[model samples]
Target: MSDQLDIDYTRRNKKPRSLGDSERAKLEEFIEAIHYSARYSDNDFEYRHVQLPKQMLKVIPKEYFDGARGTLKLLWEEEWRALGITQSLGWEHYEVHEPEPHILLFKRPINYQPPTH
Candidate 1:
């Protein structure tokens, strides 16, 4: 007989973490809300084939364009506040008459410093 032994391998990094039932239910509720919003919009929004920052993309879900747009708006507001910038702007939606859809956020720069005599 050979001296080799068979070893069973398990994934070390894939362990499942348990969440409380209430927490799980809340998560499911949020997901369902997002899904419903994604499916029932009359705006006929389409997905745009544009590359966005990975960190920015993580705030919203990939399935719905509105989610991404909303997330971007919130992020931009937060950044502006943190950077002491003051200006109000809106997002623009456009289609290239090709494939996919995209939303662009435009902001006007403002001077936050006080006027001096």
Candidate 2:
């Protein structure tokens, strides 16, 4: 794994001058979760969703989500399997780190199929 997290700042616009304290905290939480799941799961496990705390949402703008989504996906896929579990079970297993702040968990529908046209 690379020492730096891969965030797509160009997708939206110019790069963020810097991350705010709240944004940084949210990012850290996200990174840790990915690392933990990856460390514990096997190659069969797939990333089904991402749970973001509500409080973190308030602090992070939509741009952050757009920019981070791709990077997060890559991290989850690359690291989560090396650990041991068969599959990412999905958002149903997600739990908020804090109760006061509700987080948005990104879950990919199991039935999702690509368009063949």
Instruction: Give the Cα lDDT of each candidate.
Output: 0.26, 0.33
lDDT of 1: 0.26
RMSD of each: 23.8, 12.6
Over the full model, what C-alpha lDDT does candidate 2 score relative to the true structure?
0.33
Looking at model 1, which ten-residue stretch has the lowest summed lDDT? Answer: 1-10
Using lDDT as the measure, the top candidate is 2
- The digit string of per-residue lDDT tens for model 2 on 78-107 reads 222321213443322232233322332223
Per-residue C-alpha lDDT of model 1 across residues 39-58, encoded as one tens digit per residue = 11123222222223333334
Query: For each candidate, what TM-score against the reference?
Result: 0.19, 0.25
Worst lDDT run of 10 residues, candidate 2, spans 71-80
